[model samples]
Target: MAFKIGVYGSNIVESERALGLARELGQALAAHGCIVITGACSGMPYAVAKTAFEHGAEVWGFTPALNLDEHRRAYPQDDIGIYRRLIYVPPSYHDLFGLTPATAEQDWGARLKYRNVISTVNSDAGIIISGGWGTLNEFTNLIYEGKPIGILIGSGGLADELPVWYPRLRKKTASPVLFEGNPTRLLSLILQRLE
Candidate 1:
């Protein structure tokens, strides 16, 4: 089976530069014969998934909703056209009521974090695009789990900040988290590490 690469980032607060970079990354990963995995939300994930699909890569989404109706309600303006497979993770009672930070054992952000966990679990490596709290959460999860990651620097948001914080992180990974602003080179480096 093709290796799955998880694409995690912001659902909102996207810039043209970030979206374009995401497309390039997707295309590169697809060209390398890797399947793209995502949370199936909007912004960077959608942008990446679209280009990956166009490049003939199989895209998979781990959605938080149980069915189509719930998905539509959760992401009314988003598109799921690029996903070759959609895995639904039903919302738990905690997801509906809990308001704490996401942990490895529990659902957070109304099961959105749970979907992030599922995405990471299914992928061999991950690419972090411009994002906010959700992206940070996913990045932390990947690092804690010892999964290799690529952070797209210069894309704004968390991607730009990771390089600064990475050096200070007390917990380290032997598999380095590669950071590059240039999309082509970044993709090449990520594939090199993974392959």
Candidate 2:
């Protein structure tokens, strides 16, 4: 099975540097024959997924919506074709929590949290670029589960901030976490530990 690597980052990135790094990471992941996973949102993660897909990598997405219709209606900017498979939180799982379409909009935070958990847990390891609170949530999940993580430093946001937080947040079972500014080298460091 191909190694699954989750790409976590800002959903509304504006920095050209960050976008470039994301694209580079995507291309590198594809070249390495790794499966790319994302939250199915826009911005940095989207850049990674799209580039990876174009490079013949199998890209999977964990979306916050309950179904395809909801995904389209809620995230019209997202290019769904970039993903080989898009996973949604099961309708039954939502129903159990009373999360219907009527409530989905108001409960978007919860929806994303659920999606993050599923995506983070499914991946063998994860890479973090420029990110915000949502990306931090995914990072914590990876840390909690003891998954290997690669952080592209100088990508801004959480990637830059994680160094300050890692010592406080890292657990006893946490796997090796690499911080590098070069996308290719960062991926190489991650794959080394994975192997």
Top candidate (lDDT): 2
State residue 20's C-alpha deviation in candidate 2, in Å: 0.7
Summarize candidate 2's per-residue lDDT along 1-195 as a digit string, tens digits: 689999999998759899899889989999999999999998898998899999999999999888999889877987898888999978677667776555745667778999999999999999999899999999889988989999999999999998888878636866788899999999999988888
Tens-digit per-residue lDDT, 1-195, candidate 1:
688889888887478888789888878888888899989888888888889899999999888777778778778887677778988875453555565645733543557767877888888888889888988888988887787889998788899998888889998665569999987787778777776
- Cα lDDT of candidate 2 equals 0.89
C-alpha lDDT score of every prediction, in listed order: 0.82, 0.89
- TM-score versus the correct structure, for each prediction: 0.87, 0.93
Worst 10 residues of 2 by lDDT: 98-107
Worst 10 residues of 1 by lDDT: 101-110
